[model samples]
Each structure stands twice: as C-alpha cells, then as structure tokens.
Target chain A: MSITEQRPVISKLEQQELRRLLAENKRIDGRNPLQYRNISVQLGYVEKAEGSALVELGNTKVLAAVKVGIAVPFADTPNEGILIVNAELVPLASPVFEPGPPSEESISLSRYVDRSIRESKSIDLSSLCIVPGRSVYSLYVDLYILDYDGNLIDASVIASVNALGITKMPKYVVEGQAIKKTDEYFKLDLKDHPVSLTYAFLDDKYVVDPCLSEEYASDFTVSMTVKADDRFCAIQKNGGGMISPRRVIELLERSLELGKELRTVAYRQLAGGNG
Target chain B: MLRSNEQQQRQRPIVVPGEYVGDSKFHIPGLNVYRLSDRMLATTVGLVRIDGKRVDVVALKSFYQPKVGDLVVGIVKEPGTAGWTVDINSPFLAFLPLSEYPEKRIRLSRDSIGRILEAGTVLVGLIKDASIFSSPVITLKGKGLGVVSNGFLLSITASKVPRLIGKKGSMLSTIEKGANVKLTVGQNGRLIVHSEDLNVVMKVKEVIGMIEKESHVYGLTERVEALLAGRRP
Candidate 1:
C-alpha cells in the first residue's frame, strides 16, 4: 500500500475554498471544527507481534507493535535498558511515501510519542536495566503508517502509548551472570501517565483535532504532551505564520483544558475499555 | 493578530527557551519556535516541524537521532534481477547485492534474484546511509549484515533492541551467559537464536516473547530474566 494513496490531495486554492465554508461554521464533513472525526482503537491485531494495536482517526490509520529482546547497552549509558521507536510512512499508507527507510516526518512522529512517555516519567527506565553496566532489556516500538487522512501523529501516539500501557513483561532471574526466564509476568508500572494533543490554527482560529481538509489549510499546528498531573513535558509548533503572544496563551489554555478529556479517553482505552 | 498589553506581558515569561512556566503540571519553562504549514508558533512542548505549509505535531520523547553505522535488521521483499529488496523497517527497501556474498554467488541467464533471497528472509545490515531518497538505505557489506544461518527467528518489539543490547553489550552477555546460543538481533524486530539445544533456544524464545509483550514496563530485564530462571530445563 502506498502512503500517498491513503490521502486525498487538496491544493491550496481548494483549501482556501474549503476554509471559506469553515469560516461560515460549515465543514466539508458538515460538522464543527472542534468535533473530531471518528476515532477507534484495536489491540492485538498482529498475531506475530508480542503486543500490537491499530488506531484510526477518520481515514488515517496507524499500526503499532511492541517487540522485546536482550541487547548490549549504548556506550554512553551501559547500565540502563533502552527503548527505541521507529515509524514508517509506507508507500501503501500514501503515494508520497517511497519504499525505503523512515522519513523525517515519520521520525519526528515517533520521537513525539517517545518524548511523552519519557518526560512524563511514565515508566521507570532505570529499573529496566537488568545488570547495571552489563545487561538490560530493550523494548522496540515500531509504528507503521497504514493510511493517511490527517491527525496521524495524534492517532499514532495514542495507539502506541496505550499499547505499551497494556503490555505485560515476563518474570526472569539472573543468578550471578546467568539470566533465566520464568512463567510469571507483570504489567508495567505506569506512574504519572502522559498523553499528547494536537491543535491546528484554522481560519485564524485554533481548533482541536482537524481532519484532512482543515489540516491542509490550517495556519499553524501545535502538539502538546501533558503528563498525568497536567504538566507540560514537551511542545512543538509548525507553520510559516508566527503566532501572536495572545494566541499562544490562548492555545495553551485551550490545550490544557482539552488534554484532560483526551487523557480520560486514552486511559479508558488503555484499561481495555472502548473509546 | 492583535494582543493586549496584558497578553504581551503574560507572553514575556514564555518567550525564553526551556524556562519552566505555567502550573507545576503544565509548565515547560521556555518555549521554542516551530512550524505548521506556513504558520509558526512559539511553543513549550509536544510540537514538530514539517515541510510545506502543513506541519505534523506530537509529544517529544527521548532525543535519539537516526544515524549511520547503526546495526539494523530487515525483511526481504520485492525481488529484482539486480538485487533482492529488503524492507529495513524504514520507508525504503534496502538492496543486497549478490556480489557481496562470493561464496553463495550464483549466476543464471534468467533474472532470479528472488530465488536466492526469498520474501520473508531475515537479515542483519548496517545503515550505510539513512537519508536516501524518500527513506533510509542500508547495506550488507559488513561482517554481520548478511544471511543469518542456522537460527530460529523470533519477533519482538523494535524499540527494545537497544535495551536488550544494554550499554556496551552487557545485556547480551547476560542472556547468552548460560544459554550457549549465538543470537543475532535486528532493529526491525527480527531475532535469530542459534543453539544445538532446542530447549535452550525455546527458553530464549520464551523470554523474548515475554519481553515483546511486556517491554514497556518499568523493569523489563529483571522480568525477562526471572521468567527465564523459572523455566530453565
């Protein structure tokens, strides 16, 4: 599947025309801008993967998998187990993507997901290092962009984090230098959980969760990572037009307010409840 | 866009980069400028820059960047006469030349690259170039990035490979200590364990399978090792 094929091309002129409709409180989908497209999450889809999930926001779809293994430590930090994340915008997900390594866009999206979990202090990484300076368990989170509509980053992050949240680690022992596995297992200790929210500036207004067309014509985009305590762990912005100081303040307040609801939805899904 | 004096004053505290502001939970200190479409926003956390006017955004996790010289694992797909195409978990399929393996080199009048490297063959390779057109490119020119022989393949989470390796090979040593196995890990989520003892291979496979399912927990290594100890044959 080509990544480009998953997306519907809308030129700038076409976007402007759509925006005109949006300005009148009319969207192509005939809904308010703040209203999200349909959102759904499914877990345990990839039978081969230890843990897998699929998240769809409207037409965009992302598949996340969690793989486990033993690995040597990085040079800088030998004692701690590490977590790595990689994302692919498969040509099947959209036509713009070519079959190769990850694009910068895919990399950034994975990093964004990684940062929220890291900075929120969700999982204690230090505990994952089996033998400090000698051994550790490496967890790999691979995300495949199966389809592209809009709001992929948000969908990807939610699916990945929730998948990790629901994962269970096996019980093991290390006698001297030897490590062995047991039948027992336990779930991860997720403290002070975090989630990310995406906001788009459209028609000179900030909207939550823009679909493909609104995303196309939006003035700027902001992604905010909020921890359980509602602290901001990370934030990023993109656009040619600079946001005014007032707009920035307004956006932050709005994000903070919306994040609580998003977090609730994520937790319910992570807890195996439907969203 | 217009801002009142009070709004500008409130913004003054947010202009600095990496300065903690807002409430304890919402604070990121200073803000950095990032782009979306053609619009730019001074933000504190969870945003990204993209080409064109439309930008994508997400929360920031760790700051690990993709680089050359990294060891990766990929799957062989789309085969051609010149080379067999391998999907390295990136956006592109890495090419493995038949010339690289002088021992297994077979010549035929017909285009038969797929015969040598059929689809689903797991391989280990080095990231010779990560910024190839539309995706990263890998090469099998080195010692380890070639056909993995005499091993049972296991799939795990891709992110856990680094942690399993541990700082400077410590974690690998722990897993290999008693198992007596030659294990090869690929970044794209393929693991090959070679051992004469099927029991030991099965043990390692169980550990990896557990890790794949539970690597997101706080203490993954201990959990994996504990599981191994209980099931030792």
Candidate 2:
C-alpha cells in the first residue's frame, strides 16, 4: 500500500491526457485498456530470509520476505498455523512516502494480502502445526515496497504467494518435551495460486492495472483476488466512488478471466529456476 | 560482442551459491567463486565469465558499488559540518568533503559548504576515493560534473542497464538518436534524460521497456530504430 494524497497528485493536463487515451482505448504504455502490465517474479532475492521474491509489474516493484518461527498456536485454531503479513512502504520508492511508521495504505495492503492467501486456502496451514496446541510454525510475511508506481496490492499478493510457495521448512523432530530441528528440509505444501486484479473505474469505464499517473485519474478502484478455481477470495474498493450491482458482477467476471491468464504466467515462472 | 578464447573455454552457466562450477584443476576459481579442494563453487547467482586465467561471475542483479573513476549522480541527504552525506543509491551513503568541491578552494566553514550544495541538491560527480572500511567519497572536480539544473530522472533494473547501454555504447546511441533525447545513464541504474517534452520522456520509457523485454534476442538495434520510426504495428 502507498500513500493516497488528499489532493490530486497528478497534473490536470496529465490527468486529461490519461482520460483521453482511455477514451480512445489507448493506454499511455500502448497496452489495451483491459490489459495488465508485464509482470516478472524473481524468487530467492533475499537469501537471508526463509523465502523471498522480488515481484516487478511494469514500473511498480515489491519485495516479499518470509521468516518462519515456532510459536504457540491460537486457542481457537489450535490445529492450524499462523500467517502474519506486514507491509512497509519504503521512502526510497517515491517522494510521497515519508520515512516513518507504516502508513494506513500499507496496513490495508498487508491485511488484503493476508486475506487473499488465507481465504484461498493456498497453503496447508494444518501441515505447519508441530504439536496440536503446544507448538506451531508461524510464517511472517514481510513485504517491503521497493518502488510504488500503482497497483501495489496486486504485485504484493503475487509476491507473497510465490514466496510462500517456494518456502521449505527444516525437519523438526520433537522429543518428550523439546523440539529439535534437523538438517533435512521439506518443501511447503502450496495448493493453489491466487492472483489479484485491480480495475480503476473512471468515467463509467474500468481500466486494468492503472499506472501511477492513471491512478490519479480514477475515482473508484475495485481490487479482487481470484483463486485458481475462479473463486473470489478477497475483494476491496478503495474510498472514491460506487459501482452498481451489475457493474460489480461484470468486474468479477473479468477478474476471473484475467486471473487465469496471470496464474499461468505466474506459476510457469515460479517453476522456472531462473527466478 | 566477441568473446575471448578463455571466455569461450569457461561455460557461462547460471549458478547459485554452493553450486559446483568446474574442477579447479581445469578452471581456476575467480570472482564470486570459491575453491573447495578440487572444485570451484559459485558464490552468487550470475553468469560465469572468464578471460584467460581470470574467471568471474557477472551478476544479473546489481547493487551500487562505488569504485574509483565511476561517474555517479549524488543526491544531498545531509549537509553537516564535516561534509555532505550524499545518497548515491548504494549500500553506504557517500561523503563529499568540502575540499573536493573545485580548484577555486571554497572555505572550510559550514556556510561555504552550504553554498556549494544544500540538502536535496543533485550533482553528477566521480568516486574519488572508495574503501570498504570507510564511507565512499565523491568529488565534483571535473567538467560537466556538478549540480544538475533540471532534467527527467528515471531508473530501470540495474541488471538491465547493460542492455540499455549496449555493447560499446551502441544501444545508448541508438536510444539517443531514435528518441532524440540526451540521456546520461548511471551505472547504479538511475538515468537522467534531458527533455522538457513529456512525449519525448514517454517515448524513452517505451524504448527502455522494449530493450529490457527483448534484450536476449538478436537484431534488437534495428527493431528499436524501426519502433522509433513508427514502423512497428
């Protein structure tokens, strides 16, 4: 998540040009109005972290680092493990981001990313449990925003899922009262890949993956995370404008369609070792 | 680009740390590769490049490593009594002492230093002194190397920078001629394209993306020229 300025961040002339381009079905970068920018995922970026991925979607960039720790399981979900998502918008990314605590935008970003993975049941949380209620593996997903152009949520979610997918847990053998870590490591059980789609509603038209300049041209932004099965796992609408029921449903349909296209590329790249 | 005989002898395989490259007897361990008894192991993810007895791994991803004789754009982050702590987009912030300002010999006082460069000032300078133990140093004691008046600043992946600046700067000239923009590319990944027209800036961005996406393919220079000429559909 990035700071959403109170006033218009883009120049009026730039905003006018963006709208004019969209009206003519021409994107500033020559992509179709319904197209998303090219996304490339680089895994194992932060070798120190348990698992990490650097996700680049056009000019926007985000890095997700996963750190696994052993902790007590929650009382209610004693059988399941915990996954905490934290996002930080680095000041080096843009001028608007200040050097300080996490912004409200970043907080929303972490929650949305957490919900997408959680609601989609992408990881087998139960498998992360070591001892029913006594001990469980805690996966901490720290998202560091390297650069913010636009559509941070979509990029963040993709990085988080792929980072978790490539994660491997060291073998743990529990004694009478002590848990010991072994030299062996087992790959994580990644079940599904979920992708998020951001559509900017501007003048009754919804454009996919709005760039930073184009972001300021829209009033309402609808973002939805779709699972591999074409199910909506997470959906959000940033404060701006409203959409009718028909429009929301139509956006959902489009999200599912784009979700398949993005998933194929995302997973294929995930399996590719170069990342 | 033609490869040296030794470069051809050394296989440029993408290797991760701890992966064995070759037998040390056949190939000597070079930069980013360590010797372990009889085998040479890679220490990073990069293409292994060898020139004669010297074998080195060229990493695709690059971090700003300040070295002597490199031209860099420095942003003034701190203007203190000692000197200015400039953000060179590196692991360590570089220091620009007041003495290295120019031959005119500005006063050593803080006020005099402020006159040269204040916080938020961006200057193009050279890495005069660089030591891993100490903060790297920069100097603005050369021509065309001083505070930038105004220009468009942008960055692409540092690894992809080589593609933008082609072999022997062939690609850089291609972009400058095709887009009609004077651009100075910093090895650290940031670039300054001097153009007031937004359309020109936008075109440069397209040119960069095209090169980055198709850098591996052959005959990229002509494709970029044709794209600039509006011959591409």
Best candidate according to DockQ: 2
- Model 1 agreement with the true structure over B19-114: per-residue lDDT tens digits: 222232322222244434433554544333333433332223222233577776666666667666666654455666666443454775654677
Give per-residue CA lDDT, model 2, range A86-193, as digits (tens): 999898997677777878878899999999999989888998999999999999999999998889999999899889888877778899999988888887787888
Off by over 4 Å in 1: A1-9, A272-275, B1-233
Docking quality tier of model 2: incorrect
**Clashing residue pairs found in predicted model 2:** none
RMSD values for the candidates in order, in angstroms, are 28.7, 10.7
TM-score of each: 0.51, 0.58
Candidate 2 residue runs with Cα over 4 Å from true position: A1-8, A271-275, B1-233
- Candidate 2 per-residue lDDT, tens place, B151-174, comes to 666667666677789889998998
What is the lDDT, from 0 to 100, of the residue B176 in candidate 1? Answer: 84
Top candidate when judged by lDDT against the true structure: 2
